[model samples]
Target: MSSPQDPYQPGQPGQAPPQPPLPPQQLPGNSGRAFPAPAGTYPEAGPFGLPGQHPPAKNRRKLWIILAGIGGVLLLVVLGIVILINVAGSATNQARGLADGFTKMVIGGQSSQAYDEYLDPALKEQLSKEAFIAGVDTLEMDESCKPTYNDLQVSTDNGVKAADVAGVITCGGKEVDLAYRFEGTEDLKMTNIKLRPKA
Candidate 1:
């Protein structure tokens, strides 16, 4: 018989004694929870518990909206510039047309119409219309009164109301001086005109 202290000596035992089963693992706070493997693949979390890459689409859309707004502003600026240029060009053309018409009327012996168109309202009020027409008609008859105009140079300062015009006129084979003052509009009315015989 085996001694009590030697429960089953290796040499005398028919088989090894059975071992005790291990205790179950305990999770920290939540006892029922199961831990995943450290290297396992899982969805990533981003700021505010949102998916990491989900906001890219929204960010892209916002960027496009901003770009479109910038483009619209640029388009408006370009359109405004175009409008300003066209208005300036139109004003210049109108001044030139008035100059050309005045030259034609004076040179073609249409003194009544020319005087009516060329004189400022104040000047016309000072000189009777009939008297002004008669004077221009007589002047047109003078062999020394043949008038020719050079290119019209038009400019503006404060607006269409403050335009200036200057050009050369040849009368009686002699170059004369001509100038216009815009009064409340760009309709260049003749302000000062003078003629002198060629030296």
Candidate 2:
């Protein structure tokens, strides 16, 4: 006798064989996540060599160094600016002090001393000591006048620094405006002087 009817055999006339289960990708309600591969098998390779691998450690370190260098350069630039500002301010104050001293000496009847010590080479070439003294006597400034400066400024050109100071000197209730230009901060010297009666 023949073997009992094989139920799942293909080409069997009566019954159709059962189908295998569908892959996860084709399954209904699947979230599209792939199944894990067997051990020793790898997933798709990415640009960085592996799917979850990071960039090389050397490259990351280089990036950090570059950023730090930029930060250091910026810090140095800011520090340099601060130092330059301080230097300029110091020079301005020194110039102002020199100007005030010269004015005070001249008003105190020390015109000879003021001219000898404070006059710049350029000014001396233009005005003799006698002429300067004569000019001061013309003003007839009171020896007790106290000078008050209202305008002060400093500038630089071609690596040379100069200061301009304008002030009012009150003598015997009469006010006179005195303006001066001083050159060279290190050894300050009066380059020009203007004395006019206050109107």
Candidate 3:
């Protein structure tokens, strides 16, 4: 008649031994990633909340917008330069056309009209109308001198000011080179003219 020995004691094993502390109780409705894990849980709280988290997504978007704006500005600048070059080229071509038309008129014996219409205003001031008529008459007297179109070249020195046109006129099997400069905004006007006989 002695007190019953504890059944769970090592040598008195008649009752079932305790099952491994019930395998660490998991919090209900949690994926076991909950912060401050439940009491007697296996996982412990790890990292704490950081103050003022960065908006990485928003920052990335802003950076892209800035880059796009810069690119757009550069593109517009390039386009402006191209447009300016085209405009200058057009002006040069127009100047060459004017020179070609004037040369044709003079060679076809319409010297009077050429002298009156194509001469620069400054040149007209230097020579009287009578002198121009006399000079044209002298040129036309060369019956053997057959004038023909040779070549035309156009160039631009100052895009804002004027265009330079070079024209070659073949006469009597020889070449006569001339330079014409044009100025003005909407309607370009002849500003100067120079003639040279090519040997």
Q: What is the per-residue lDDT of model 3 for residues 42-118, given as tens digits with 9 covering 90 to 100?
A: 44333443434444597789999999999999999999999988976776568767877766776667777887777
In candidate 1, which residue pairs clash? none
**Candidate 1, superposed: residue stretches over 4 Å from native:** 1-55, 127-160, 171-173, 185-199
The candidates, ranked best first by TM-score, are 2, 3, 1
Query: Model 2: per-residue lDDT, tens digit, 1-199?
Result: 2246744667767665687866545665757766665567676787888787877899889999999999999999999999989988888788789878998898888999999999998999999999999988888886778888888888888777888999899887788898999887467688999877889
Of candidates 3 and 2, the better by TM-score: 2
Over 4 Å off, model 3: 1-55, 136-160
Clashing pairs in 2: none
RMSD of 3: 7.2
Relative to the true structure, candidate 2 reaches a TM of: 0.65
- Give the per-residue lDDT of model 1 (tens digit) for 96-189: 6666676567657676787777767776777776875665554434434434445444566576444455665556445545555545454556
Instruction: Report lDDT (CA) for all predictions.
Output: 0.61, 0.84, 0.64
C-alpha lDDT of candidate 3 relative to the true structure = 0.64
What is candidate 1's CA lDDT for residue 173? Answer: 47
**Per-prediction backbone clash count:** 0, 0, 0
